[model samples]
Target: MMPLRLLAALRRMLCLCLLAGPALAASPTGWPTPYTQVSGTSVDWLKTKGWWPLTVAWQPAFAGQNATVVALKANALLSRRGLDARFVPMASGVAVNAAISDGSAQLGAGGNFPLTQLVDQGAPIRVIAITAPNLKHQVIVPTASPIQSLSDFKGMQPPATIGLVLGSSAEFYFQAAAATHGLKLGRDVVLKNVSQDEQRRLPAELAAVVPWDPTATQITTDLKSGRAIDVSYPYNVYQGSFFVREALVRDVPDVALAITEALVEAELWLRLNPALAADVMAGQPELRHFSRPLLAQQLAEYNLLYKLSYLYPLGAFWGRQNTDIAMWLFVQGKLGKPLQGADYAARFADGPMTQVFDRLGWKIPARPPYIPADFWMNFVGNTLPAYDTYLTMKGPQAWPEPGDLTKPFSFAGKVHTP
Candidate 1:
């Protein structure tokens, strides 16, 4: 024998080296860096997937995601569900729209603004589900500000610095709301795009943030700790939907249905296991903006929102997308009239939306939800809060009536805001 002691030492070294290899490959230090190999080799199996194997193009703002976890767990879910799919990550709605048109991805998630843009572009996609009308508008005033109601905005200035998740479906609702209330953002009041982390400071000047999400916990905590308060109504009723390419609606409707089934199941799972669901969802890097309590509240809110309109609202495809919003925004001048009538439905395939209801053995209700909250919001929390879609304005019993075609009213060839 070479030497018993030396042989034992060599074996231990080999074991140590084996353990060290993966740690080195993982790059325990650095900014989510790409995995590196110890030396030049035929292949680096450890880093084969690379960073963010996702499509990198269609990056929809998730309510909350543990994308990393979803990435790790998704394939198994798809496999078990018999979904022959790939996560094809894309960075923007523009890219997602292109992918669907080019046949790269059959479906993707996005907000109403982009979908509105898609209709204008004449892209071949359509709405599959109305996830939830955004509840993002918030008139966040510090526990100590003088701004009590919309009237307090008299001398306010822009850059009011309200916290918001940039580029979400909530944008549309805010646009509609500000106009409805005669409040001109970036003018009358400012839209402050601040991160969730920075919000703890409770900036100096904040009239109210639009599409604000302050759950009952946040509300109660704010009351106790004296943080933000309800300057605006609690609900955001802008309609938003889950849309997909039209071809998939017909060709591979089952795949669409399968995905919808996952969403339905995920929604239920979140409802039943809230804290755990938040734990999983928090793992998603994109949705890290929210706190644990906020995330939990969102899961419950989404679960209730989706189940409200119809048992499975997605399956209720009327062969037409809701373009009334487009018309409304166009008149308001926030958008251009891209397309009109039933022709707008050409943007998507309906097989997935329809088949999902069939697969689940649930009934899809009649007519697409003109306003999702009408069916859903009433059932969301223990005591539902009032919404912002339609507000009652004071009539002749109010102000001194001043009539003037000269300046009081002039058609800007569009709907006037103030």
Candidate 2:
């Protein structure tokens, strides 16, 4: 060698260049080799026989409800469970719905309105599980505005302009509220399309805006600039749903089950560690606009509204809610044609979630419960006691049994250490 020290430095530089070349040039089409084994299957089988790195479209628009996405990004859930999946951040359920329909994403999570729209389009999709119900969407007004309720907008001189993303669940909620208060779109108030972020600061000309949390939460609590005149509940159930392609469910049952288990476990993890989950969400670029304290509040609100359950409640309450929304949208001219909730409910692929519950040794409801026709008149508090009874209870109630949510929960015989 010319010099021992120089020769060693040259070797180190060569190694650095070699590593940098691949990193700069590599465009990965598949997950790395030697995939972790899940349910006796590996990425070897997935690549050769099944779909590898299943593309999951998750919406940050849902805020804290999408903690599962946050966990997946941190490689805390799906990777830990040996599931080869990629989490794609989407702007809203609207985008997620399109991804699922176009075959870009095999799995997606969306709210009631987008899900209904996707089903109405006759896409090859299925509702696998309910993500959450009673997610609060509200009609918010600036603190200085004189309008105290939706009724105040009725018969305005120029028809107050309400800001909201058109054809969104926010619109769905606003419409329901308008109808109840004897106001109609274009009659009492006009529409101005605005993103949820824009809704955080009500524009000068806009009278009010409709946005779901944590935008709504931020507007009302964190920013303290707006107050909600009306809310989604008692008008719309507003269930956020997790849906998948029928082909994925039919072809790769193991993959589907693993994904569901990961999601359920992620939710449990959020329940046990709301603060940590909030911190994770704050780190996401899409959600960076929201502070950790606000996210913590959103998670707290979610944990308060719904309990952890992966199984789809396929009873009349759910059926009628779905049907009612579909019918309403159809009549509102938002949909091309009318659709029965049963038309899509028939496709509720509960197999994966069912397996998750079975593995946990939890009692699964054998039959869907029936709800009286009038129970929906006051649907908020009118649900039957046994119909998804675990949902309303606090602190993560285990179905038909009590569990210690204070302790760590496990899946696949592995306790969640994080």
Candidate 3:
């Protein structure tokens, strides 16, 4: 007494099974075949689900700073390992963060500024690893212009406009430079929201452009009139981080671990073979617009490192720097308020990355102490008084400590619950 609907459904399933044949019987139960292998190693849990062709979002810049190299090599590494993944180029870090936030992308890579902003605003993502530090961001002016330094832009007869993308690290550093020169943003000088493309056509009225490479390199190299005046900040160790959605970390941690391992390997490869790495990065479709020489020049400027042993010295400085930037944003009314130490801990998850290091038997490096308050005060310019007062009130709680991987993933001594 089988129901007519049930019988029809059964018949269709039978036909499908018959067509599928012995291949169906031999096939693994749930997960997609040949997509979960990692460097020729396979994990049983990775075979429990069918997540294939992992999507990574990245910002395509001629500068080898973004995860372009890592993403490119990771695809090949995974393919060699029998997994499949691809990196989708987004317009900017903001777009990449949005893509991960909306679940369109499982992972992303970018500078700490936009990524931190997204996490502060409750994006369902966590920074799993810090790939590199000390990326060069500069303020460049035409060689023939009277604006030789940041101070020269102050009190011009006609207000000068600097071209920079809004909500970027360039804007932050530009504001810092103006503050240092006793000038206020929007009053002493104006800022125009210009994209990388628009920067090439910089107007006569534009005093300078604050940009990260390869735009910075391209402009300075192509225009004989261009001269780089100043680097954005002194402790110019701003970092690039890898971010993944919580869902991916929660559901497919092995996949996350595998990707992290692949990236670490890729980083080591890039460091060992800069020439080959440059060639590989330049070959990417997003970067084919630029010449190989430009790509090599940009690559020369970058110092990418991912070894767990190097994390402490770099992470300590970067954590303090990140907190300072966050405080600056809050004071400027860009952020609602300064985020707490626990909040930063929740944003950065070092466990998965540490596990990879442990698996490889790499020794963890010693943790470096936080940078003194005065050093930060000098770095932030005229905001010293306000920053000093804020620090006194909050204590040193917001500054992150070098995480103890042996215990758990914690920042500023609090466990990261997320």
Tell me the tens digit of each residue's lDDT in model 1 across 196-258.
Answer: 334444545544444344322253253332343342333233344456555444544554555
Query: What is each predicted model's overall lDDT from 0 to 1?
Result: 0.44, 0.67, 0.61
Q: Write the per-residue lDDT of candidate 2 for residues 159-213, one digit (tens) a residue.
A: 9999999878777777777877889788789999999877877889899999987
* Local accuracy of candidate 3 as per-residue lDDT tens digits, 52-84: 566778776725445344544534755544557
- Candidate 2 lDDT at 342 equals 73
Clashes within 3 Å, all models in order: 35, 0, 1
* Reference-based TM-score of each model: 0.58, 0.78, 0.73
Q: Can you rank all candidates by TM-score, best first?
A: 2, 3, 1
1 or 2, which is superior by TM-score?
A: 2
Q: What lDDT does model 2 reach?
A: 0.67
| Candidate achieving the largest TM-score | 2
